[model samples]
Target: MRTIGVLGALLLFVEFVGAQTLDSAQVSAIDKNFWKTSLPRHELQWGVGCPLLEEFIIYGMGSDDLSGDFDRPHNWFDKEVYRGSRGTTLFNWSFSYLYRVCKFLWVGADVTYIGFYDVYYDKFTHQKAYINSDQLLTFMPKIRFSYLNRKYVTLYSGISCGIGWVIHSEKKEVNVVTNWAFQATAFGVKAGTSWFGFAEVGLGYKGFGVIGLGYHFNRQNRQLFKRNSL
Candidate 1:
């Protein structure tokens, strides 16, 4: 009787253990629960995201060369010019289009807008400058990978590419015309309550870093296979 009772208990324990719930958070990364998807990988993650940190190509696009061999230090701090180019720093933002491949990865494009700043300081002028790129509305296709998928908060890294079709506005004061495309590298962390409020910082091209904050959005009331807009 003792042997039989012990055997029965062992069987009962196995049954109970098998019926227990798996950690849905961990599993939801690999599987899916209530939330949606993120992009590139093309699964289901719907929320907003941004590149809190990034470097832009504008800085690296040219070597620091401004004409004038006779230019000298009018102040204590002056940098030598290389070519016809100076440094450009940029800030970027992208709305969330969560197309998930799995728990660890997402791919989508950002409606990549930039706040342009020139990076130069001097005893001549200890001031930073913010300039507008001739092209402001561009698209950046990005990939986000989460280190730990914490529903409301996840640590992620993003890389993106840029392209633009722009017609200058009167605010620009010049009729700039043509197609512009930039290839950039960026990575940053995000922290948020919902998809709507998050921030990040990372390096991009042109030897500069960028930071931005924006809300994440759900891809709802919209059709599947709608495709990322250019």
Candidate 2:
């Protein structure tokens, strides 16, 4: 009888352990499903870039005539001609917000600022003629598509169109300030877990080359497929 009782207790213990293991598996599956279906609705990012690189392109686009040496020198700054030379510096920064529409797409908006300063010299008068500083503020609505959305890195491209307002000192001015602006192409690579760093380039908004950081409101949203075993 003693032997039989010991065998029965052993059998019962084995059955209990199996049941517990089954319960744990079921719980894990449920958790996975819950996470897979839920995601964050919004994200925010900030970036900075050098806008001065595009100064020549921006100015050249506006003028119909460039008979002078301005086009020949291939120089971005310090162009000296019949008049005294002029020099410029620019900086770009932006804050953007995004709302996830689905797994791979997002629609959002951004506000970008391009700040520039110029020094002008008039050789005819042998004097510093003007010092001009201005800021261009642009508000744009953007759409983005993300690919290879993995935990470590993601690739993305986007486009934006909007209006820009030029804010300048009353004493100074710029030629061909295009109030209507459009960014037809923007592409970048991002890396991180939940908080990320990115390097991007685009044709508009500060012209090209952006580096920045972003954070996802939900940690689970970082994974491309959340339901998969982690």
Candidate 3:
């Protein structure tokens, strides 16, 4: 009976030790995952988006009243000659650098360029009369709020406001205009780690929809992990 009692005690002791070991292993795994999922401190991104806002402004500026009386009266009955203008927006290119200020906040600056082409044609003849090209460059300070920061996916919204320089060229004349510029991102999603692809739905200089690639820097540090573990 004593031998049997000893055996049972040994069995219980073994089970207890095993449970402790398993618990330790589980805690270690959780710690490792926590470190792995930590956010980076800095990021750089490059993106391209449709220049909807830029195109709208360019069209307004380029669509002047070219439908006045012609330089010379034509044989054809000329009531009021009408000129038609068409505009093509190339794209909005943006590059930005961001610094993580807190767990759910980031601050950054963005540089963006928008290119547009406009052509005016005679309505009756369909002959191209004038060509105008516009280039808009903007520099803005930006702020982002990250709602979800996961290991492989992140969701954020952002806003930026600053000044833009518009260079308008028509024939031999060049004009430079400065104006206020802004972008507001209602939704944004980023997928990946270290290197990632992102998409943003927004308005203003960045366009209505933006997609880009980004790289994270200062992501990992062994010393920091060790300190946190302790």
TM-score of each: 0.41, 0.60, 0.68
Provide the lowest-lDDT 10-residue window in model 1. 44-53
Would you list the C-alpha lDDT of every candidate in the order shown? 0.42, 0.63, 0.75
RMSD of each: 16.4, 19.6, 18.1
On residues 1-230, what C-alpha lDDT tens digit does candidate 2 reach at each position?
Answer: 47744654464445445545654665656663452335455778888876753454344355323367556676434323232334443457878898877645679997887755655555455566566655677888987766444557766677778888766652344543557765534457888756788887666775577888988777554454565746
Compose the digit string of candidate 1's lDDT tens values, residues 1-230.
47744654464344334323333434655645333543223322222223222223323454444444446546324443222223332234434354665545567775655434333343234444322233345555666655545545655555555665443332235454434443232334455533333434343321134343444444531234365441
Cα deviation in Å at residue 104, candidate 2?
0.8
Query: Ten residues in a row with the worst lDDT in model 2?
Result: 76-85
Residue-level lDDT for 54 in candidate 3: 83
Clashes of 3: 0
Q: Candidate 2, which segments miss by more than 4 Å at Cα?
A: 1-40, 52-54, 61-89, 122-127, 168-178, 219-230
TM-score of 1: 0.41
- Model 1 spans > 4 angstroms off: 1-96, 115-133, 165-187, 205-230
